[model samples]
Target: MKLHVCLSALLAVMASGQGVQAATPDAYRDLNHNGRRDVYEDAGQSIDARVDDLVRQMTLEEKVGAMMHGSLPAGDELGHGGAIYDLDQVGVMIGERHLNSFITRLVVAPRRLAEQNNEVQRLAEQTRLGIPVTISTDPRNHFQAVLGASTAGGGFSLWPETLGLAATGDADLVRRFGEVAHREYRAVGIQMALSPQADLASEPRWPRVTATFGSDPADVSRMVQAYVEGFQGGTDGVRPDGVATVVKHWVGYGAEPEGFDGHNIYGRVARLDNASFAEHVAAFDGAFAAGVAGVMPTYPILEGVSLDGAPLEPVAAGFNRQLLTDLLRDQKGFKGLVLSDWAITNNCDAACRAPTADHPQTAKDIGMPWGVEGLTQPERFAKGVTAGIDQFGGVNDGAMLLQAVRDGQVPAARLDEAVRRIMTLKFQLGLFDNPYVDPDVAERVVGDPQSRAQADLAQRRAQVVLEDGGRPLTAEGVKTVWLYNVDPEEARRRGWAVASDPAQADLALVRVNAPFERLHPHHFFGARQNEGRLDFRDGDADYEAVKQARAARRSVVAVNLDRPAILTNIRDKTDVLIATFGASDAAVLDVATGQARGEGRLPFELPSSMAAVEAQDPARPDDSAAPLYPRGYGRGAPRN
Candidate 1:
């Protein structure tokens, strides 16, 4: 073990090019320009001692800055396009604000990302304390590219969404995926992952179902545990080379009352009864058992819920002490850092609270203060700190937190406590020794052939064949194919000629997504979110295409089930129905042509009709009356 640690340290030093000799175990960085080594800078000292020493030495301004995890702004005003980092903006955050943690929003290649992250760390090295920046990011190794939920796969190995992983019902596969994602993320210099969302997919119409592990608490628990274990290197806490995983949205975030997300004002509260809410809490047991490094509080205010027979404080989870302190920290014993969801403390202005068609909301207008919208910014910060949040995500205003501390709104001890946790993680991650990563290694390691092969296999296995119609799907009989929403080149690669018209083909290959409606276009995230109506209706483009293909020939349909769709209307229209969650064209083709067998089950039940969807409770799972398909139903059989 000792030799392994030494070798790892040596590799990190060599990769970083920091010139620190691995033979000298007591080596330290002279961050303060002092002749003597500070306790925090000495690599030989214990982590607790280093954290305490660092906390004691930090100024109030620096401590406040440490609690704010802001975004690494883009180079130009159009922040969404380029991967280039705005060094000037980063300098202001690091040099003036004293921040050492940031979430990178740049969507670039692995080498460019690593180089930019190294530049950020270089700026941090010049600081008075030289605390290394711990960079974090949302889930970027999947197909979903929602603005805040997930990012595009880009150069990373693409896998099916978490729901698809749940469909496979293989905890080992989920763990393997985490291991791959960890390697890819660390290759790009990301130290923290804001993912492995433990929230259950209880609500059929919820927009974020693709990111969850499904509605069954037991399945979610198993998947979550495996996910954390894989990402953090083991079942034990974060290892030195491991990327820290923040299992998120603490409790009951999936029970959206009317299929509206908590990001907008229309979905401020998640309606949950006591019994149903317990199931939501139980879903996170896997993450807690794995000793996840961090937890992100949910944005929605959990309504009709309580703890120990007392009603929960009517506030968002970030500001609710009963949930964060009394339950999460006390009863559950989760000793990790608690990061508040983005903009929880930001004010809800006119554009935020209510945007018109003429004045549509954007990123700047996002805020989810919920029950405490009346409080001042400093007061909100104090409330969040008191509620047990160690860091505020998507926030750069350290001044507000500093004011809260100076004015005694937030106690100084709490500030130090938060700092200790943050610093301890940085030390545990070996960031102080060497925060840089080799860009060349990043380019080679990320999206390697082996990882891609594993991910592609997973994508194929995760396809849930809901309706096989007693006919095995095989490529032996198929000659000419008509493709809808499938690439013609993929058909040609499979030794099948592509036919322009479905009537002239031997088989019709059609793919569609589970139905959704954009109900709130005026709100920022709401506009992009897949909200409302999980049923296929007439005139719908995807449904029309499916009907057209079925009318011509035996149509084998593949629907991307981002949400549990009401498939009663289209179930009889096709010969075979397969459900996918972020699968590739090749993967779907492989399953459709019997190149690979879909060894997956339904993560969430398919409601028979929209009536059943509306009549069922949003807080419960698989309770719709006369469901089209029950949870765990698949073509071949269910796996453990």
Candidate 2:
């Protein structure tokens, strides 16, 4: 036994002499339980000094983890976020994975979300680094029909969706909406809004138009700037009361064929063949001008596209140095960190080419190497980092990143640079100074009564009258009716009679969605695929019902245009036709009852037919000739 022990000691010493290094304690010290009074810990140091000190003290694993903003385990909670989650998983993500941030998905109770966030921050604080975990959320303040925002009216202010906001053409109101959303976000311990989707809504059939400002680049730019101003509270940096806006998809996302989303390769592949690149850049320019902190790079899984001469061959802005490092960071003069869209680097599997496949064929949470389907998972990470991106979304593993560094694919200095940017935001946000939130405060501020009233007013203001031939929907005539989109309770509360049967009413009212191919929710979100074209066709159940109702009685119809639906068949069927981007059921009813007049105008063209849709180029903003409803089409105050 003595001989064996000596041999083991000698081997270890030999290994050390061969340059094998053991894990050493980082530069942090805990003398007097106050931690080392390093420059990074000092509140009075320059931002550069603080970032440098923090980078030097972090272990490679910690530095890698700092670059990940993974998804929160929202499965066990209330909403459709993560597939599964519990306290143990949270522990692994923060303590073991060393993650310091998570994207908030799906909706839980307001207080419940706050409590969970508090618990998460507590766990993060207990880690060796004690970095507070930042929480981010997609847009949630609006009542968008599709899976745009995760939550709807979940104990927060409810406003019109972005389309509705655009229809209003009120930049000031958009900014105000931003302010409200930011306050509520902060109240719930959410520090980031992965929104103000600066992508132009030129693709009429695009599924995500519900979340856009509009198709007009100039107009969209103005709103984008306003949104940032509101969310960031006009501060060039993060503030305790402010929220950071991650202007998304970088650029050129809305140009997808028939308006498919970029959650996968096909949707992301359909780019503008000859569209105005300047217009696309204009949107990001607006956001950057507002001093936004970060940009979520666009998914570029295309056949052929070049930026400044470099190709998008590996497929993704996350891996394209020309687009991320050169164009955005160098030429465009953007100085913010670039974050990859969720799982953009995931390795493709059985459903690699069929992202919309059902059941087992659906894509998994494994790496989705869309453009660079040829690269391994570790190589994908290294590629993204080399492209000048600072972080990966929804990626929890830091081991792969460490491996990449060891392999010399990503230099330690490059890793440090990424870590520095991330740490700068955290410190600037004062998360290190104070990460805890008062649930009581969240309750008081979030969904406050005053905020609700503003939301109501905004909702009322955003309804657009597409066709008002005979003033058929005036308040007097809407008293007794069959209502579809309008909330029955709200209509009744307003002294309007609500009829259960369509035939029992004097007038028939219907609410229909912008059309698209229906796929399982799991396929659309969990796998991030299955969204398809936007042309509304004849003979669908809802369309038939609306047609039969119009034949039966004087009818009023409101089509909540999530996208510019193919309106050839339904446009001429109703006596009064209205197009609302997204409003409350009550807000719709308010317009129908003439309690509040819709001041909104159509933000994009409503195509006459699918042929028109197919005939036009995805790059052209408004080339739908003889549109059923042209851009900026709306009737105001009954043409009086």
Candidate 3:
């Protein structure tokens, strides 16, 4: 794996001579235009030597371009509640930015995604150095069914969300999912996965619980190790067959101040004291053990937090050298890419707000350079670099990077260090040899039938039943079922009779989501996805809907707990109570009818009431209010 280039290839590259020789009309000779074969172009050298050679050859502009990773011109995909939407902002990030990496979204067709990625690679190849672009993406194959957060499988095999995966509690199954995700991603030219968040879900009211593994340190730790192992094929470094992982929020983000989200300024720190830090860092410790390829810092303030007596200024992790360099790299011995969360280096003035028209509660538009608000953009970049961050997400500009170097604010050696890490990934992924993807292979592999079936099995394993209510859930005599929010056609497909009206059915199957009361509930209306929070205010529409359905007939209520929710409003209003972390309708139906029994357990506790949630210590883990259902409480059986 260490060897890359051959002597014959080097001779072929070197024979072109100086001044860029021309060959074969359309094909230009000396693709790198260096006239002589550079050490970087030779795959026969060690990775460190190759990185050093590439760094030496790069000018300031090229080096800056290598550091930036910008947004791609999003193509047609299910945007904002299944609508035909794309990132319509017209910018020259590609032609002008010249960044070697891109953060992309899923396209409606897998082939089109691969084709567009190939086109981006072509764009990058046109540069002087000809570095192949590495496409990075958020989690796209999960079944969370959100708009801004995730896509609708988009023809890729859909597996349970991370919460669902944790629910299953099967480390091997998680590893298998990593294998599937890597295969599908590579087929479409996606080399990086900005996911597998190692953060805990200790705070029940946290909004991003849909993305976290679980609350318990032990359970989350197992999943984190297995997931990285699966994606990296148990290798300590990046591989051609592997899709490198970016384990996120580096420190725990579950215990947000007052249970609010950290993407915005109001809730910036994981308020927990230094004593409770171990549980927060538990899964990350496991990620370190699993040898993850990259780490993403959270957008939260850690004013009073520190490791090994190192003094940390009250600021976001991205700008803290003590936290990043002293703690993560030196103390913990992490050898991976350190990436900042999106829009962190920019300023967050009043006018510089995040996008809130769609997913209101989680929008983060303004810059979040918490402790270094006094510094200029170039100064901020210099600080992050000095803090041990390898790359800056959300923006792909090198003006600040170049200026930092010119001002003597950042050393050239630091730039080389960052570029070396970046170059290693590009070389290790085998992007230097062949970067373009074949659309045909993408079409077949993105959702291979075998992978899809395995995903379905994982889905089945993740469904959890809390209370059966002394009722035989899947009685043979129960034929007609009324569905509220549950798809009628899907129920009929599952061999059950579907009735539109509750009064006209044998049993009413009401599928309602967990209650969420956002802090600001305005400017969010039509064509938008649901927001996250645990408060179910009295007379809420969703709660009222379930109550009405239950009154109409003897109903079975299943709550989709994207995050740990407060179910006091509708807990006693139904016959059977089921908690689904993130599973398919078919999986839910199978579990309901006893066709497939759930083997999963609750990963977090459901709060008894909003009052209980509000009274708990926001600075501590597993210190929530009285629980309606505690963690690891799956009654009767744990069957797949």
Q: What local distance difference test score does each model get?
A: 0.86, 0.71, 0.71
Q: Candidate 1, which ten residues in sequence have the lowest lDDT sum?
A: 14-23
With a 3 Å backbone cut-off (N, CA, C), the pairs that clash in candidate 3 are 4-43, 5-43, 5-44, 268-301, 303-314, 354-365
Evaluated against the true structure, the overall lDDT of model 3 is 0.71
Superior by lDDT: candidate 1 or candidate 2: 1
For 465-546, candidate 3 gives per-residue lDDT tens digits of: 8777786667466678877777788877757788767777777777777776555442222123234457566577767667
Candidate 1 residue-wise lDDT, 1-640, digit = tens: 1222344345344553211122356545666656567888778889998888888889888899999998888854323666688898889999999999888878888889888888998888788888999999889889988888777845999999999999999999999998888888878788899988999888899998899999899999999999999888889888877889999888899999767899999999999999999999999999999989999999998889878989999999999999999999999998889998999998888998889999988777878899999899999999999999999998876988888888999878888888888998998888887777888878887899999999999999999887877888877667889989999998888788988888888889899998888898889988899999988888999988988887555678999999998888777998888999889899998887788989889998999988888999999988799998999889855555
State TM-scores per candidate: 0.96, 0.89, 0.88
User: Could you say which candidate leads in lDDT?
Assistant: 1
Clashes of each: 0, 7, 6
Per-residue lDDT of 1-640 in model 2, one digit per residue for the tens?
Answer: 1112232233212211011122122322121134345676555677788778777778888889989888776663222554334668778988888898788774666667667777787677577656778788888887753343345656789888888888888889988888888877877678888887888777776667778887888888888888998898784645545788899877677777766666644455756542365677776777878898889887755434566665555466778787788888898887766888877767656554444435433424334466777777788889999988899987877777778888899987788878888888877665654555656667777778888998898888888887776654566644577876556776678776877777777777788877666453433343333245555557676787677677435777788777787667776887777787767777777776677888888888887877778888676677777788787777862342
For every candidate, C-alpha RMSD to the true structure in Å:
3.2, 9.5, 6.0
Name the TM-score of candidate 2.
0.89
